[model samples]
Every structure is written in structure tokens, then in C-alpha cells.
Target: MHDFLVDLLICPKCYGELDWQIEQRSLNHIEKGEARCQVCHTSYPVQDGIGYFLLPDSGREDLWQEVDSHLVQHLQQNPEIEKRLMGVPLETLSPADQFFRAMVHEEREEFELAEESQSVANSGIYTDAYLSCWQSQTKYLMDRLASNDKPLIDLASGRGYLVEKLAQNHDFPIVATDFSPKVMRRNRRWFEYLGISDRVSLLAFDATKMPFKDASLEIMTSNLGLPNIKGPSELLHELRRVLAGRFMSITHFYPVDDNQNRELLRQANLETMLVRDLASAAFEQSGLQVEFTNICLSLAEPTPVGVVLEGAGIDALPVAETNLEWCLLEAQQSSKAKH
Candidate 1:
């Protein structure tokens, strides 16, 4: 974690300021340390320059745990280059996608052992959608926000693509927060590998209960992560509580036209609508004004599941266009609460 960002962190349980104790440091990077909440006396560990301001358990256990375990094992074997990517095995892609693919590769065995076997399909979709969305808009969003001098936080940063980009291109302080330690660990390594660890800070914290004081953050962002969250309303409220400047996000929205698309939305707890409807509802709920909104077709091709349309032949499969809808929303503080 960066030395300056330590002042902005608070205890999620009591909302009190955190007192950080540094055990190891390299310039601005705190390689090993601990953060103790002054009010509640709860202590959170800082590992590999990333602070984990999260609960003992976030109740999420699955392929990620397996992936982290595997990575930890690999790191143990190659301690010399653990912080650097010199010894890590990754495929050819953007650094973020390479880390993601590495995680998926490491977790395959444990994924097969799971009772439901959803990880296989979910991981593929996740990789495709995130790569597509990032390639499509994340850099553009960062470019728009880069001119601002205020501190920026990337909420639910899946693989820290924006974080890396912003850190490399700008001098302003940047922080990346995610609920998964495994993902953040990869992010820390990536930063180290790219020689930008001093420019970025990583934290593991729940989105619903971020460890920041009210209005402490100037800008917040998330790319293709809001829909996976269970409660959009609560998240928006939390964003409003912590963000004093702007909140921008890129989400995958599907237009519920066909039965297959509708079913997909139902399973994901999503609704189909125009890009404006989604942006308006989100901004209204968060008490933020919609400053900008952009809609575009998804770059990933939809994989057909071979379901026949209602009016088609009995043996025919419905040829539906991809339900993937890519949307961008830029919102800022509003005086009046629309909801």
C-alpha cells in the first residue's frame, strides 16, 4: 500500500481511522505491515504490499481459493522471482488477461472437483467479456479521468487493467480495491513486474462495505463488475457515501428480446432495457447525475446453446444475435436525490 493512502483508510466495522504499523518498506511501498482499527481494535494484515481490509472470511470459497493456493505454491518454489513475473507462466495477452488466464489454468483441477461445475463456463465467459469490455472502453474511461488531480479508486478491480494503465500514464495517486485476495495478489505482482508498484496501491475489501470515510474518494470506477454484485441498490448507496466526485462504470447489459436472452437475464438477476434506462436508474438511486452515457455492441460473439425459437421448425435452432450490450455511465454528485 502507498504511504499517502493509509490516511484515507478507515475501519469498516467502526468507521474509525486506521493506525498502520510498517514492518517492511521500499520507498513508498509497504511490503509488510499491519493496520489496526483504533476504535474496534481489529487488526488487518498487509501482505506483499497489499492491505487486506476485509473480514476474516468474505463467504466466497471456490475456484479462486484453489487458484490462490496454487499460486502460493508456485511462489514458494520460486521465491527469487515471486514478486517479478520473470518465473511466472502466463499466456500471450495483455498483462491483466495473462494473469486471469493463469488463475483459470491453475484452478482447473479444483474446478472439476466442484459439485456444480459452473466455473468452467463462467470462467470462459468472464475472460471473454472482460477482455472485450476492456479493449472496448476501459482505456477510454481512464483517458477521460486522467486529467483530474484527485485520488482515484478502482472498485472491484478484477485484474487491475485500468489501475495499471492509469498508474503508468499518470502521476496522481491510484488505488485498486477488490474482494478477492487472489486477484489482488496477481495485481501486486503485475505492478512489481511492470516497475509501477510505487504508483498503485492494492486493497482487498468488500464493495458493500468499503473501508473509506464518507466523501473521501474523488473518483471511483469499475469495469464489467457491477452486475455480478447481488445488490445494485446497496452498492450505489455505498458509492454515493464514499465518492465525492464521480463514479464511472462499464457494464454488460443484455436486451431481453428473445426467450433465451430473457432467461439469461433472469438467471443473472439482470433486466433488459435501453442504455439510458439503466444509467438513469443507477444514477437516480445513487443520488448522482448522469454526466455521460455510452452504448455499444459487445465485441465477443455469443455462443449459441441450440435452443429452438417458438415459431421455428421443431428441429431448428433459433439464430439469435449476441445479447451482450456494453454500456458506460459517468455520474457525478447531485444536489437532489432522484429516488
Candidate 2:
């Protein structure tokens, strides 16, 4: 982590000032170190330039990450499966199988080829309306970020496309945060490979237990990540507490009236983020002025199951067809709260 960012951070446990002891340094950054809270004495480590500020009794998990843990283990044990999938012509495979192949390539650290395969897979899954909405939001976000050079924190980044695009196009310092150490570590390597390693800082910490001082962060962002947090009432309040600027997010909400997917969202307890009114009210109650724009809707059908992998469930999406309403959620810290 950069030595300069230490002032922006606090002990997640006690919200106390930290005494940083640097063990290794390279140029302008601290490669390895320990941060000890002055009040509570909890120690958080910094490794490979990514600070670890996670709480042991954390209430959040990025379980909504696209890469499935089980399938990774499956591919690790079955080496021949990867070979078999790669040998097949991409032209003939089902889109779901192509997407699965792309993920396998990602697991193997062949990111360039994985990206190519992912594009091919997405063409089949996302309708033109969906693609247009995504492009619009991404452009909107980049345009918005162009005006500000402040340090920005992205919550539950999950190695998603949103942050990578930001790091490539924008000059500002960006912090990509998630609760998982393994994910952050892999992302550090990925950024290095992409030649934008200097553009981003990785911090592993729970959203509910922020390492930042209250209203200290100037800007924040997410790409369909907020909805995935386990319980967001506390998360939203914590988000409001830390962000003094706007939180710009690119997300899509499922049709609430679609009974086909009704039970599914309820079972997962995702009404707050998936239901428009509930999501807006949740953000408002947390002391933010919430608004959504760039609104559009598109027909979404069930993604084809993995035919090449013998239908072993490549990934999960809605099983029924529905209209997905895509929007850019922009929430600002309430002016009243500033006083």
C-alpha cells in the first residue's frame, strides 16, 4: 500500500488511530507492514501492497461473485476437463459452455484469451437492449469520474469489469476493496499483468466495518456489488457514514411483479436492492439523497445450461424470462447530515 494512504485509514475494530510499522519498502510504497490500533491494540497486516483490515466476526460476504468456489475446485482436480474444453471449437459450443470455458481460462491465468471468450459468451446471453444499457452506464461513470481526482473506494469489487475500466481510463487513485484476501491477492496479480498495477490499491475489509474515518472518503463506487452483501441495512448506514461524496453504482433490478422470480429473490432476501422502491427507501433512510438514471429495460431469458460440460451447471441466473431494468444509482450524502 502507498504510505500516504495511512492517514485515510483507521482500525476497523475500534475506529482508533493506527501506529504503522513498515517492515519492507520499495520506492514510494510499503510492501509489507503491520498496523496496530493505538486504543484496542488489534493488528492488521499489509502484504504485497494490499492492506488487510478485515474483521474476524464480519457480517458480510461477496458470495455473489461470479466465479463459483465449487467449480474452481472441480476444475483443479480434473485437469483433463480444461484440455477437453479448450480443444473444442468455440464456434460450435453453447454460449453457456463458452462462458464456462472463459472462466476456466481465467482460473489458469490466461486473462487475454479469457476476455475474448467472455465477449463471445456475453453476445449470446445479453440482448442488445441490455448491452446498450450497460455501455451507457459505464460511459456515464467514466464521464463522471473525469471531473474528480480524489481517491475513490470501490466496495465489493469482486474483480468486476467496472473497476478495471476505471483504472485504465482515469488518473485518480482508486482503492478496490473486498472482504476476501484470496480475491484481493489474485486481483493484485491481475492488475500487474494488465500493466495498471500502479493505478489501484487493494484493501480487504468488510463493508459494515469500514476502516475509513467518518465522512473521510471523497468518492465511492460499485458495479452491481451492493445488492450482493448479506444484510445491507447496516452496510448502507456504514456507507453513508464514510462517504462525503456521491456513490455511483451501475446495477440492474429484476422485475418485482414477475412471480416466476419472486420466490427466488425473497428466498435470498434481496428485496432491498432488487425492488426499486425498497432500494431507494433503504438508501434514503440511511441519510443519502438517492436517485437512479439511465434507466432502460430488456428481455432476459434463461441462459442455456452447460451442454459441453454435460450440463454440470456452468453458473446460476434467473430460470425464467423477465424484463431486467438497468439503472445507474447515484446517492449523495444528505446536506442535513453534513451539519
Candidate 3:
């Protein structure tokens, strides 16, 4: 669920209060219920666990129906996964981790699926888009290196996309760490496939409790990876403790806005010296100084018509879209002088 939906729990059209119906859980059957708008008497269907406030028989019904059907089917197929996901304390988990777990649950069935099945190779839809976006960011970072020999670390690096890209051009030692052994194994396979197994090292480490000494790292990068981090504040402190020079992270706008984001950082006692946008912010809050901040537009191209048609095997194509975007950020970090 996006932040917008979380905040606005009422029906958009009728301005009615909505409630969750737990009994009628089947996807195939349209769950009968009503969201009575207190003011407008506009009753909306609470079908398939989603509260639809829009006009009945509107163009959006099909879309909402599909989404509700998918949700119901998924929950039914994987009750254990659903229970585990729903059991997480939303307020306690970092916004990033909450979002990460949501994505992981949606895709991987609570990380119980085999690594090979969940690997990028199996998901052409995600692989193409993810590779394109990260490749652009990696090339941009490479341009900034400018003959400098700095050891780089990728925290929570799943499948090692950025590390693999960096190894292709730079000879610097790159370490990719994640908590999942299954993910790390897949990452190692990618490294081997690219013939850069020796250049990149894969380690199993928790984001909150990194296995590195103080002032050991020059550059640290987490690409939309840290949000799935539990105890984000502690994780930030750990990142600061390990970094000798700089730390850069790309995250999402969850728990929405800078205030909530900063609250988490401050709780960890991090001093965010610079903030670029809702998507990214740089913390010199740990007594570090910011050297540079770059915000670039990163985009992913849509699957070509031929590929989509071939994959779907449908000449009658529905309106299709891609997950392209322009929200990319990079920050440079350095140590600050003590008073």
C-alpha cells in the first residue's frame, strides 16, 4: 500500500468511512459489503478487501476488481506468509523495511521460494527495469570516481546489480552484503557469470548490525535497499561508524515527508547535513561533511511491443505501461572536524 492510501482511509467520492471486512475472503466471489458515506449516502462496495469509493460500473472497477482478486488469491494461496506479513509491527519497522517486506512478500512468498526461481533471470519484467535504472546510476557513480581508488561497499545488496556493474569498469574492491544467504548465492552466481567473482565479495550481514570495523569504508551505497532495514536509526549509526569518508543511500518516501525521515535519523542520533528531495537525503548528522549531492533523472524503458506481444501472446493488447521514473539521487560524504 502506498502512503496516499494509508492516510486517506475514507471513500474518495462519498467521503465515507471505510472498514475492513474479514469474513468474505474469497477472490472469485465479489465480497458483498457497503461503505456508507456518513454525509452523502453514497454506498460503495467493499469487495475483495478493497474499499471502492468510485462510481459503480466506472472504468476503474475492472482495475480495482483485478487488484482485489489478486490480493485475495495471494492471501489464500499463502496464508502463512500473509500472517507473518500482517503480524509485523508497522510502527516499529522502519518505513523502508516495511516497504521492502511488502515487496518481498508480494513477489517471493515470504522469501520461501527457491533462489533460482526468485532470481532476476526468472522475472524478465523486473530484471529489465531494475538493471536499466541501476546501470544508469552505476555509470554516473563511475564518472565521479575519476581515478580514485576507494573501496566501495553495497549494504543490503541483493543480487549485486550495482556491484556487478561497477566491477565491469573499475578494479576497486567491492563488497556486497545481505542477510539472506539465498540472495547472496544468487549474487555470487551473477558475479561468476560476469567473470568478476574475484573483484566482488559477498557477505551475509544485517543492515542494523554490520560486521565491519570503525572508519573502514570509503564509500557505502544502498540502492532502495535500506528501507527494508529494521531499526533504521541504528542502521544509520552503524553506517556512520563504519564509514571513513562517505555514505550514500537511495531510499523511498515512506512514513512520508522529511520530518518522519529525520525523526528516525535523529532517534539514531544522526545529523543529516543535506537533503536532496523526498526520495533521498544526506546525513552529516554523524559529524560528517557533505562534499557533493547530485540529483539525476533515472528512467527505465518499457518492454518493446514485440517482446510484450510475444510474451503475452495477445494481439489485442491492453494499455500497457512501464515503471520508468526520474527520481535518482547521489551524495558524497567526508568526515567533519571535531570542535
Q: Please estimate how well model 3 matches the true structure, expressed as its whole-model Cα lDDT.
A: 0.48
Residue 281, model 1: Cα distance from true site in angstroms: 1.6
lDDT of 2: 0.82
The global Cα lDDT (0 to 1) of model 1 is 0.65
Task: Give Cα-based local distance difference scores for all models.
Answer: 0.65, 0.82, 0.48
- Candidate 3, residue 28: Cα displacement in angstroms equals 57
Best prediction by lDDT: 2
Winner by lDDT between candidate 3 and candidate 2: 2
User: Model 3, range 24-61, lDDT digits (tens) per residue?
Assistant: 53333223445455555555554333333444433322
lDDT tens readout by residue for model 1, 1-339: 887778778898778888888999988778888889888898888887888888655675431352446444665576663434323333223333333334544344332222122333334334465455656676677678757887788888876766777788888878888888878877776676678877788888889888888888878888766765667677777888888787887765555455675565556565422234664777676687765455565544443221111121211111245545566677777878523
TM-score of each: 0.72, 0.92, 0.46
Positional deviation of 303 in candidate 2, in angstroms?
2.5
User: What is the lDDT, from 0 to 100, of the residue 211 in candidate 1?
Assistant: 88
lDDT per residue (tens digit) for residues 234-305 in model 2: 899889878877898898888768887767788878778887888998988888989998788878777777
Better of 1 and 2 by TM-score: 2
Every model: Cα RMSD to truth: 9.5, 3.1, 20.0
